[model samples]
Target: MKITVIGTGYVGLVAGACFADIGNEVWCVDVDQTKIDKLKQGIIPIYEKGLEPIVNKNFQEGRLHFSTNLLDGFDQSQFIFIAVGTPSNPDGSVDLKYVYAVAEEIAKNLKDYKLIINKSTVPVGTGKQLRDFIDQKIKERGINVDFDIVSNPEFLREGNAIEDFMNPDRVIIGTESIRAKEQMNELYSGLFKDAEPRIIFMDVRSAEVTKYASNSMLATKISFINEISNLCEKVDANVEMVRLGVGADKRIGYSFISPGIGYGGSCFPKDVKAIINTGNEYGYDMKLLKAVELINETQKAHLFDKIQNYFDNKKDGLKGKTIAIWGLAFKPETDDMRESPSQVIIRKLVEGGTKIKAHDPEAQNEAKRLFKDIETSIEYFDDNYECLKDCDALALLTEWNIYKQPNFQLIKKHLKNPIIFDGRNQYRPSEMKEMGFDYFSIGR
Candidate 1:
């Protein structure tokens, strides 16, 4: 199987590397020459666990190749995957310029019959739109080149992308052409040989919607739990106990139910907005999704309010206070800070005339870049304990593994006040009270 994956972003790069690892000759094509060059030299752009080693091994073994030229890969490739980014517009709609541009480029270079797969997360009916666009371009060129478009959206979590790819819960292939389906089955035959057949074939539109709906549902769960946590706080109920009771039901197995500041990262926020906008475009309003978005936005500020209230009770407020922030990334095991709740909390804290000392094992440089405007108001520390030194209170935002169990005695030694606001519920309230520290968390 000779395949060409356009775009070297998370999805494209992971798919290309994994395909090559499964004995397929893969050409990872990118428009950026510098990115292609770096990839060729074993320099990966992103930090996905278990990705670099596979890419390096496959490249060295002559199974994987990198190039800036899109046309170069078309010569021997049977499948061309468009894995470009669909960034969210200000109006909550997806910007499909990159997707359309890739379609036009592929149309111009088509030499023979090829299976064009949309590996990017796109709105419903985008597969048909791309197919129509390519057909129009081919007709204008007076060429008889044939191609079939299939929507094969990816479902890889950021930190566990490689594991998800190699052992996918299910593989979706969307197309009506039997020939195209047979070819895809053949290409993936080796990878699914030992596993129970988990290939799901569907219409192109359904496949496109599946990606958005799946992500939005997960986001909904997070927001729903956060909302319940807020209610629990008002009613003097412990969200942790409520979560345990609710999640004990087999129908609602405990995933994404943990009450946190909010759901953030590249996918959930954009996908929720995009889906809502998609609904509006079709004369339907996604009321539930809109509420989900609103709740998530409110939840991001929940921790900041707690910090302010804590200081307000002490007759000082956040003004002139130095707060220690543990974790800058949206979640742990990755450096992505896009739409991170920590960003929202930090920005609000800075607006209240507070100084911040933040630390994350992997996101320190990223945090520095994100908070450059507030450089005078915040400081980044290489060590977690160093960030806590002389701070009034410690705010645990991202639930990194290292922050789960820490040197509490040392934390008590550094902070001017023995106060902790845990956004991720990393510590038990009873234990914190026993240890003689003021601990605040989501809900109870």
Candidate 2:
């Protein structure tokens, strides 16, 4: 199959690479000439594990290509995938400007019958809106062409995107047309070659809702665990143990139950807000999701409170403190820092007149961009131990492996005070107490 994936963002790039790896000729089209050129030279713009090698290999093998010319991609492809970004509006509705713009462009240049897949995470009924928009444009131009809109939302997470794309839990196709279904089945033939891949067929609206509902449920789980972790701190219980006990239940099974500062990344925050806003538009409020959102917001502030409380109750009150942060990325294994809880914690700490030194394995450059305004107030360290030197205390904001089991002896020798505020619960409180250091963590 010859496929054209539009927009070249995270989802687009990953999907294009994975499709090409499965023996399809994929043209990853982007409006940004710079991005297209970089990709053409095998310079990937994003940081995803196992993506660069696959994309580069496929490009070298002549299975993948990049282009800024939409007509070139359109003319050579039988399937067009719209994998653009749908950033959330302030009101929580998904911004459809990019989706609409791509649809209009495709309508203008589409030559023959093509299966247009909505691979972007869009709102319910967006397929109908796109169908209507394309049809109106085609009629206005008095051009006779045929195209079918199929909703095929992606469920790839940031860190493990490559594996997820290759071995999807399920592939969704939202179309009633038998011809469209057969074409999609053929496109996904690689996955079904070993065993029959589950093909879910539904109306386009239901298909769109599945993407939001799936992400929103995962986000809700993260918030629920964080909320429970907060309560565990008040009740003198360990969240890790509780998680183990609860997760042992066959129904609960542990996936998104890890307690942390908060959930962040490109998908969860935006999708939860968008779904809540969708409910609001129908004259119904999503009270539970509202609580979930509030809990997550407050959880991000919890780390700041822990640091402040530790200071105030102790001899000092952060008057002349230098805190070292272990991780700056929203989560481990990705360079993405969008909506990172560490950003909020670091900004609040700096605002309170404390100096911060932070280090992440891969997110330092990305973090530097967001913290440019406070560049003078913070220091970016190449080595995790470098940040630990001469600091009053250490805060583990991310669960990077280097920070998991560190040289406590070295840390005690370097810091002015051996105080640790672990946001990710990377350390056991009993062990820290035995080490003769003041330690704090989520839950216990």
Residues 93-207 of candidate 1: C-alpha lDDT, one tens digit per residue: 9999999999999989898999999998899989889988999999999988888999898998988899899888888888999999998888767677854377888889999
Q: lDDT of candidate 2? A: 0.89
lDDT score for residue 298 of model 2 = 95
lDDT of 1 at 46: 78
Which sections of candidate 2 miss by over 4 Å? Answer: none
Q: State candidate 2's TM-score.
A: 0.97
Candidate 2 on 202-295: residue-level lDDT in tens? 8788999999999989989999999899899889988999999999998988999999899998889999999998898888899989999999
Taking every candidate in turn, the Cα RMSD to the unseen true structure, in Å, is 1.2, 1.3
With a 3 Å backbone cut-off (N, CA, C), the pairs that clash in candidate 1 are: none
Global local distance difference test of model 1: 0.92
> Which regions of candidate 1 deviate over 4 angstroms?
194-196
